[model samples]
Target: MKHVKIAGGLGFIGFHLAQKLLDEGWLVTAVDSLENRSELKLALEMELGRNAHFTFLQTKIEQVDFGDADVVVYAADNENRAALEAVLRKCQPDCLFVFLSTTDVYEYSGEWRVQPVTEYGKAMLAQEENIRVTCAETGGAAVIIRLPTVYGLHQPYHLKLGRQFVSYEDETGKTESMHDLLYIDDVTSALAAAMAIDSGQHTIHLGSGTSNPFERTGKSNGLDYQKAHELLGFFPRTSLAEGIKKYQLAHEEWQRQKKLAAMYDETKSMAAKHPNTNQ
Candidate 1:
């Protein structure tokens, strides 16, 4: 079985990619510090723990034991940058290093505004260069996959509209430029395909090549997937409407769970404060 180690293995993209690889019969090891822990992260940890082929290493990326691995997927976008070169240096000579990058390299944010690339955009560009140069030196294959805002279950709230759509129940926001958000599964599917490539360095774009108009007006970036299609045979299968419906159902279920958790907490508090109630 091919061995793969995922940095930020418990993160949104990291967790999904790790889960998919594990299910495909790869031996997966997850490297995470859990420094930025969340309810979703905890839940993901539990689900991954159930898989005997999975190993969760609670440590920083630089400290991870790459261990004769066939692949190293850098899925943690907000990890320690100072250790990145060091971490890449430790990879097995033949390991294929896959870096899950963002369109931030070109666009400002998920807003699709490309006017002046933000500082974050600059950083992503630098990181991509680092991967390219470092991997070239080590003679290991590398793939940098640039993705737009990705949304599905357990999506983060800061970068994109998906989490806000779910948590705030606000999808009616207006903007001039259209934002093309890829579903989490679509992005993961593209990444999974990278493992099949025997060798070479590549940078792949995995979303509509244009800035969509506001509110998912069905205007695409012209539905261009030329490079990704050629390289990974990648095409997104989920429509925006379908993805939104999934988010809506997830939101309703989350609300129900929140209420149940609150009620349980209240009951415990009441019982604890009034010991006689227990009798």
Candidate 2:
């Protein structure tokens, strides 16, 4: 079996990717710091822990040993360029390095360019360059996936604009926006396909390939899956309506769990203070 190591296996995207790879019969080592806002970490741990082919490591990317991994996936949120370069240098020459980048690197023209409008975009661009230079020096293979806004169950609230459409309260206060979106499953499939293909230092853009204007009231324009279909032989199977419904259900469950945990803690505190009264 091929050995895969994910740097941010506990994160929203990383966790989903790791699960997909494990289901495909690959031995996966998930290295994560467990320092994210999502409350699904425990759920992920319980699920992946049952798999014999999965291993979860709670640590930074620079501290792990990647000598035996056939592929190293950089999915962490950290933007430390030096740490990423060091990790790539330590990997075996045959190991393929896959970096998850963002479409923010492009301007409004829809063309891939080096100019980024935000700090986050600039950081991602720098990291992409680091991977390219490192692979060039080590004579290794690398693939950079530039993705648009990705959304599904357990997705971070900040990354998905659909969160605003889930409720009528309008948390973001924005009525509508035109953006490209891709389902989590489609993104994972694209990543798997990249692993199977023997592409040498290539950059691929992943998106629904259509500019859809979404309103805060859960309505959207049409979707176009031409680019992803032609390139990866894959297209998003989940409709926007279904995806949003699933996301809303998951968010409700998460909130319920959080309340239960708080109540349990409060009961314990009361019991400790009234020991004599109970006797």
Candidate 3:
């Protein structure tokens, strides 16, 4: 069985990708610190734990034993740079190092802006360079993926809705910005396809490839994935309307679960206080 190690394995994208691989009968080791703790995080952890093929390691990135791993997918954004570099150095020649980088690697401008990297972009660029250099020297492979704004089930932010935030209060700052919107499943599929390529190096930009308004003022346009399609042999299958509908359904279910958990906790608290009075 192919072994894939995923950093930030409990995150929105990471969790979904791990689930996909696990379902496809791959052995997955998910490393996460759980620093960004949330109900969804815990729920995803529990869900992935149930799979016998999945291994959850609540630890730092550098500490993971990348022993015999066929693929390494770094899905985490905020990690110690030195530690990440050290991890890259540890990758063996046969390992395929996959980095989930952001389009933020470019200057702040339109959706496809290039050159003059931002601070975060510089950091990602450095990591990509590290992956490439390390792999080139060791005869390993590396796939650096630049992603746009991604949303789906377990989505923490509602970038397009503008009406509500998924995991934050409505009073939060305006999320109105132009971006290339992508569904989570499409991303996972692209990442999976990237895993198939085990030689040389590649950098792929995955997105709708259009600077659509971030707010849901009107119908989000259909995607044109010709770039990803021609290159990766995959294109986004979910339409914006369909993706939004799925998110809405999942959010409603999450809210219901949250309420039930709160009610259960309240009942337990009451029972604890009245324990001695019960006949």
Candidate 4:
């Protein structure tokens, strides 16, 4: 039985990966500061029963123990510097560490942009280096999985650059920006493969393939998800269109639920106020 500790295991990508590992009979320890614990728990129950081969740590990554883990999958993104150090300190001396980094490390948000990951992949690069140094000193190995834009079910944001406030070179539909959209399943598969690799301190780029293009006007042009295929021996099976459709469906359901709740609340309040008049 392979012991794997996943940080941020309750997140959008993390939960799916946990499900995959559970299916494969891996002993999985999943940790997350679940922002939506109730919904996530319900989803997990639907996917992997109450007594599955998975353990949930409902706390921050810094608070957990990774000492017994054979492989540690570090997936959290925000405030990650300290979290990385904590994982290194607690991981077993020989445990293989897998760092799930963003393709934002290689992001090209125009030449004049000053964002940290965009202007320079410094912060992410620093994280990669820190892990490399830690592993080298401890005789442990580390692998970096650089993922591009990931989308799938339970997606929180709509595919609108307006939400991101990106100033595209040409706002018209004629100009299209390249976004290497990788489905969540593909990201998980790459993570799984990295866990099995013995190659020391290697960095691999992961996407659906080369680069899946997304038009500013919501049209998708599929790219060969072959880079992952050639390098990691895996390709994303989910199509970008299909993934977008799922996200839209989930979003619509969520909106409907909210509207229904509001309607129920309004009816209950009216009933409470006019009980005597009705009687």
Best by lDDT: 3
Q: Which parts of model 4 have CA positions greater than 4 angstroms off?
A: 35-51, 107-120, 160-178, 210-212, 215-227, 245-279
The lDDT of model 3 is: 0.75
* lDDT on C-alpha atoms for all candidate structures: 0.74, 0.73, 0.75, 0.67
Q: How far off is residue 252 in model 2, in Å?
A: 5.9
- Residue pairs with backbone overlap in model 3: none
Q: Give the Å error, residue 50, model 1.
A: 1.2
**Candidate 3 — worst ten consecutive residues by lDDT sum?**
162-171
Superior by lDDT: candidate 3 or candidate 4: 3
Per-residue lDDT tens digits for candidate 4, residues 26-97, read 998888777666764556534544546888787878989899998888876533688889888898777888
TM-score, each model? 0.78, 0.77, 0.80, 0.71
> Could you tell which candidate, 2 or 3, scores higher by lDDT?
3
Tens digits of per-residue lDDT for model 2 on 1-279?
A: 999998888777888899899999999999887766345786787668889999988877888898899998888864778768777988888898888887666655444355777666778888888888878888888888877667777765554335433222333532111335667887898888777655478777665644443434334432344555665676777666667776678779877877987899899999898776644
Residue-level lDDT tens digits of model 1 in 155-210: 76533444223222343432111235677888899999988875778988677554
lDDT of 3 by residue, 1-279 (tens): 999999889988899999999999999999988877776788888889999999999988888888579999988754357767767777888888888876656544323455534566666777777777777777878888877678888766544353222222342542212335677888999999899988889888776644343534434432346666776887777766777788788879978978997899999999888787646
* Predicted structure 4: lDDT: 0.67
Instruction: Give candidate 1 misplaced runs (Cα > 4 Å).
Output: 107-116, 158-179, 209-223, 250-279
Candidate 4, residue 140: Cα displacement in angstroms equals: 0.9
RMSD after CA superposition, every candidate:
5.7, 5.4, 4.7, 7.3
As for TM-score, the candidate ahead, 1 or 4, is 1
Q: What stretches of model 3 exceed 4 Å from their correct place?
A: 107-113, 158-178, 215-224, 257-279
Better of 1 and 2 by lDDT: 1
